[model samples]
Structures are given as C-alpha cells and as structure tokens.
Target: MNNLNTLIADYFKDSIYLLIENAIDIHNNAINKPNDIYLSGKLMAYVEVLSLLQMQAQAFSIPLESLKLDKFEAEKDLLSSRIISKEEIIKT
Candidate 1:
C-alpha cells in the first residue's frame, strides 16, 4: 500500500474502532438511566447500522476524498492511542 492508501486504510480502521468504543460508552450510559430503562429503538438501530457498515467496510475501501468530506481522523495525544478527534484547521 502506498502512502495515501495507507493513510486512508488507517483512517478507516481507526474510525470503526472509535465508533464501536463510542457506541459502547453511550450504550452503557444510556442503560444506567433510572427505573431499569433499556436502550431506545433508535439507538439499537444505530448499532445495527454500525455493524452493517463495519461488515461492508471490511470488504470495500472508499476514497480518501470521501473520508475527508466526513472529516474524521485518528489523532494521537500524549496518551499515544488512536482516537477519533476533531479536526483543527489552521489558517495561515
């Protein structure tokens, strides 16, 4: 894989991991509601969609431009771990 391809690949892989982590966190928090509440149908659907998306992503790769349009990246901090961080634009 070339530089751009590698970047795009890393972006996709890291993105999926981030999505799962976020979903789990949100789901855990949601289930913590009072009165033994469960996850909403909408959130369940969202997880299903993410599952399908991951399955599809495993087989196919999209263009970097498309990923750029969505603007997600695995930025590393002092913790040195991959995470979906907001993009910062520096106007020069």
Candidate 2:
C-alpha cells in the first residue's frame, strides 16, 4: 500500500513537470509568432490546464511553491498584451 501511494505521488509530480515544460514551449512559440492566434489560444489553454492541475495538486498535498506558476502567469500576461481585441481588428 505504501509503495502504491508513493507511485501515485511520483506520477502527479512527473505530470506537473511535463505540463510546465509544455507550457514553456508554447509560451516561447507564442512569443516568436505573436501574430499567430492559434499559438496564443494554445498557450491560454495550457494556462487553464496548469491552473486546474495546481488545484488538484493541492488536494493531493503536493508542494506547489517549486512549480513556478507565477512565471507562467507572467508569460500569460505578456501574451495577453500582444493580443488584439475584436474591436481593434474591426477598426483596422
């Protein structure tokens, strides 16, 4: 039973790391191609996924301080600034 519990914890930890890595890659792509709305949308989706994952991790008593969620939030904010609103697009 103890070994099973350890495996579960390790799985969640690995998942969190994988999610963070994917998010970073998406963020970089969004930064490089600011005009690509698809990449921006993908990044936003990753942010939401990470947020939910964080909540689930908390439920599992996983330590989140080392996750660097704040950095992802900052990256999201940066991408948001580059996004043009529908109104602006219409005006142009």
User: Which prediction has the highest TM-score against the true structure?
Assistant: 2
Please provide, for model 1 over 2-89, each residue's C-alpha lDDT reduced to its tens digit, 9 standing for 90 to 100: 9998898778767755664565444544555424335445446556656466445445674534433223222212112232223331
- lDDT, candidate 2, 1-92, per-residue tens: 99998887778656755666666667666877879988889988887787776676578775665443433443344355454232321221
After TM-score superposition, the amount by which residue 89's alpha carbon in candidate 2 deviates from its true location, in angstroms, is 34
Worst 10 residues of 2 by lDDT: 83-92
Clashing pairs in 1: none
Look at candidate 2 and give me any clashing residue pairs: none
lDDT of 1 at 64: 33
RMSD of candidate 1 to true structure, Å: 10.8
Alpha-carbon TM-score of each model against the true structure: 0.46, 0.62
**Each prediction's number of clashing residue pairs:** 0, 0
